[model samples]
Target chain A: MVDKKQALLLEDFDIEIVSRDLNFYYGDNQALFGISVGMPAKQVTALIGPSGCGKSTFLRTLNRMNDIIPGARVEGQVLISGKDIYQHGTDVVKLRRKVGMVFQKSNPFPKSIFENVAYGPRIHGTRDRQQLAAIVEKSLVRAGLWEEVKDRLNDNALGLSGGQQQRLCIARALAVDPQILLMDEPASALDPKSTARVEDLIGELRELYTIVIVTHNMQQAARVSDFTAFFYEGALVEFNATKLIFTNPKEKQTEDYITGRFG
Target chain B: MSGSFSENLIYGLLRAITYAIVLLVGYILFDIVIKGLPVLNWEFVSGYPHQSGASGGILPAIAGTFYLVLGTISVALPLGVGSAIYLSEYAFQGKFTTIIRMAIITLAGVPSIVYGLFGLGLFVLFFRFGASILSGSLTLACMVLPTIIVASEEALRAVPKGYREASLALGATKWETIRTNVLPYSLSGMITGSILGVGRAAGETAPILLTVAAFFLPKLPNSIFDQVMALPYHLYILATQHPDAEKVRPMQYGTALVLLLLVLGLSLGAIFIRAHYRKKYKW
Candidate 1:
């Protein structure tokens, strides 16, 4: 909700990805309305809202991933590293390279674990076998999945358990070396243990990359994110520091949502 | 549980009839294999067509069938799969595409004889291509095009929505996504359609007879215009024109066995392709 033009490297944190007046529509149905938020670098910004609140839609806008939907369209600027991603001639492939995403359900490609990790690099023209191997190893380690899956990298990713597959999907997204990661309810599909693992992974990732995650769990947003933006019915209800949003929120709706009164 | 003896008898009789039909088909297959087995030989399978009155090879006819099928595939594959992609992935769900899809299914159900007649009009007369292998293959292609298109479209349709979304989300262009992911993943199913098409093209006699108008030319065909000797036509000739010709009988029996083998081989190949992918793609 904050749109004040401040210096990129402010005292709180440097901005990485910024959205200005973003609106989304599916045919005549407006899903998101005038969502302007600045995401800080090397920190997690959680978007917490109730069902059908356009939180997912707003997360999809970061990487222009909504372009895949047949009837969906996004309006306004989504800037990554101060570059307008929606501008004409801005190669979406390159933009997505710099902005990775993970979905709610772990969607590992129907490929071997090695292939799943190497896919992004292959697409970006990395054919050197040793380099791909190194990247895969490093990414799996970064995603906290290397030791568990190291021996079975050639096996199909779908062969892994649900929790492990989610970690592998994270590693896949991380393989591209993106500066921004968009996670749309990434842990919602996992069990409590896997959810805690992903939350821990998020904690570590905030030291290196900007993260925008959409979650229905207010407790999760409070625990993992530095800043929280609460949405309701396609509108930004409140945006503030996560502790402030969860503890002493400005909006009554935010208080009710955090207190489990009317989620 | 039947209320009356008569009703129970009728139920038993109906079930017996179902078993009887299955047994009849099994017996036919048994008869064909038993009768045809003793005659099969390397000389019979690969040798040229002739010997005494009965002993000869059907090499030319076999080659004709092969070339005819290859030509049909060369022409039909791109058109069929492209149309399928357009219909399943690109074309909007509208009355036009729906009507076109319905028409294709209808074409598939039409008898081969009707397709032959239609081919006769289109290839032989309308285009004036004449009774050549090209026209024959074209007729056969049209006859099987519907099967290929429908099966492939179903395969394309069966691909989960997530795959398309994932590819597009990765910022791959639509065509590139389809080309690299969707097409490769459904190739086994597409192969099943194509193999079925080839089977029909290889065996169907009426369509080729009408479109190609097979002439008793002993030489090999060099072009589509050149009249070719397909196995189906040879069998037709051996059975009807020279029924008592003992020499042709062996060749005919040998050809029949080979035709059966061709169909079986195609089916096995399709199954193999599907199995290979099923094992390779678990995710």
Candidate 2:
């Protein structure tokens, strides 16, 4: 991992989360070296890197999604609300509820649209029909999908278009009332029109949820994110305000990547 | 060109082979239907056998076969489906799982007569369950468990991993996710597997012959411990064991036809259920 002294200044922002010297391995093959970064509260932080650069790996670590994979291991600390999630006896289920995730491909359950949104709440013990309906409506509206689907809430979610399916996944995540939303290339599989709509939705979601997104599209990072972190070879190369990263990058690697010289 | 000519020749050969198989099956079915149709009236199905199964219907055999299939399924379905779930979802993929799989495959290839002898030694003699429906059903269940387990495992594996990950990512426990998401989706497959096993178990003669089949009982079994008249055993007697076997030719044909229909009906039911579930959950 590259040495950086700027981590000392991480406390300057209203930090919503922190990772201190995080290292990860998949069965003795280290996928991430010691990495550290802080994300501000209620802002969009985009992680940009080429494929297999550990950007998606880092995003998954936030919600302990790596725990499900066999032979995977993690070291160092991921702190949320001043608590290390990796600490012994941490409630992983509760942690996931607090840090929701959307995958690269849309994965709506084979359930009705309403059920897809109500799934999180129902699992978390919401039983009243009226209450579930309210949560489903609020989440779909927040995801910018309520108007398109409200008339057919009972329809199977798989029948929706691809863009609508991704948005439904987003709405499903939001229904759990998580404070942080981690999206891994949530728009990568969409057409240009759908990509714009999802990007616009991300811009709107940043006001309420602290969002961390991984994107291969550099312009998408520059468009929706307030802060940008450039990662390469499992290391954070540069992180700064999006405008500064795009216009006047401090690192030559970042400049070259932004200019399409190389990945 | 010559390349297209070779392709056409290969395609024609494949079509001929397919047609050959269909013709063979059609000929067998046509033979059975014609020979058995004369003795297929309701009286032949519901009446008790007379004169050592040389003169009457096979109602007792039909009921006995039904009970045996029911008992075998009840015994096998839970064990098979549970073993499948454990293998697919919980067991680590290593030497232990490999050993388990090898054991199941070996069990599946064991001869039916060997299973019959083993059941006779265990359930009939050691356990002293006697030559009864319970003993026969247990024996048939053991014989078909391997089939059900293999099919159920395939069914469970058909479910995509995305559903599991999606559920777990939402903070559901592994059991909760399996129960609500995985089990519901795979249930139809499991049932289909059980139904296919039922078809096989229902037609098995050796195990039941040793453990439960009676030579000429004309009454329905009054309890699990009672010896029962099964269709295959009855047909075996009518064809070879009766005093005047040639005189009971119609009875033999009818018994064979009924057993064939019962097994075919079960297999068709399994196929129908599998197709319905595939349409319901495309993923």
Candidate 3:
């Protein structure tokens, strides 16, 4: 654990999320240790690591999805847009609405495609059919799925292909009009074609949403992200520009892991 | 000793055992239908009894059975399903929840005659509701409560956890998620369970015998307080307790057939609902 703290020099680009010494635990087992990183606004920051390296755990901390697990606890601060979300009396529902999330496997509700996209607005007290329709359409279009699924909006969302279902989940998260989007291996389960489609969709979504994606594919990290953070054994090993992390030297562990010598 | 020959023998034995059970059921049904069909006329159904259920229709018994089923369901459905939702959605894993689950299982195993005695002591004596529809319905509801809760809870549990997570992640409150997503998918299961409970409630003679059933009141009940003739109790009296039980054999068969049909009808309806839901949500 010596020389473990090597801070990345965050340049003047606006930071959308800041984690100061975040530690997370599930019961007695700790999963993340003193992870500190700044994700710049409107740019995709990819968290890449070997399996069980706490990248997904860190990703879930941003939206507080880890709160669902029993005996799961978090220490330290997670600030989004300058507000400390872990502070007491913070409305978690409001926080989730602001910081939307897409999970590893696509989990569209067993509902119609239109309803899948419109679920968020409907629950937040939007009763008018017209407004819900408009929001659904806008979300689908932003997710790059509207033209493909416009005519069959009433069809069961489970009937969609794997890639479409994943995109539908993204559209659902976007329908809430969140400032930040957290994706946990959003394309890991899809075919290559579907993965390409989702990657392209992520490229478009980055312009409006502050995207933080957790991926297993290093090539995917290089292709889609501006910044990359490498994690190993529940500690953040390196965080820098994707080009520098990929092309130049950093921590011996990161260079070794990324170069396929060992995970 | 050949493998295929032994496999064929096992298959044949299973088929024969299944056919034997089916044949027994068919024989009983055939006997009942043939014996009851001779007297099961419109007049026999609609007309009032002449001399202590010796002749005429079993209208009052039919009406009483209907009332008992209605009252039992009205009392049990909400209580059972509410407890089920609480158990499945809200109750934490602890000693208290375990106690509740154990109590429900124990209640399901209690004998119908014991339920009758309990109803006799509680609703008839302590509460002084006396021998009336209210007492009978309350007793039957208690008897069926465990069934409804178990079935409804199973249905609630069958709803995928992912659905609940998706709803909560979309900023829906826990109650809102349950109301919209959980309840809709589990409704068919709940209804099917309740229907099966209703069937059990209808056929239960011992509970109603002590609580509400009358041996010879061949008329419709005007109020919940009225003691009425129910099909199962009526059939029991005509079969065993009547002064001339040997002469009224046809009426006994008819009553038995009607009760069987009522229970079978409810069970079939539940089957239909289960099938419909299975088609709608394959996941």
Output the worst ten-in-a-row residue range by lDDT, candidate 3 chain B: B274-283
> TM-score (chain A) of candidate 1?
0.95
Each prediction's Cα RMSD?
3.4, 2.7, 2.7
lDDT of every predicted structure (CA atoms): 0.82, 0.90, 0.91
Report how far off residue A230 is in candidate 3 (Å): 2.1
Task: Kindly list the per-residue Cα lDDT of model 3 for residues B1-283, writing each as its tens digit.
Answer: 5999999999999999999999999999999999998999998888888788989999999889989999999999999999999998888867899999999999999999999999999999999999999999999999999999999999999888878877788888889999988988998999898999889789988899899999998679999999999999999999999899999999999988888888898899889998997677656
C-alpha RMSD over true interface residues, each candidate: 2.0, 1.1, 1.3
Candidate 2 TM-score versus the reference = 0.94
- Please provide, for model 1 over A59-79, each residue's C-alpha lDDT reduced to its tens digit, 9 standing for 90 to 100: 888888887666888888888
- Candidate 2 per-residue lDDT over residues B224-272, each given as its tens digit: 9999999988888888888898888888888989999999988898899
Candidate 1 Cα deviation (angstroms), residue A196: 1.3
What's the distance in Å from true for residue B129, model 3? 2.7
Give lDDT tens digits, candidate 1, residues B170-194.
5566787788668877888897888
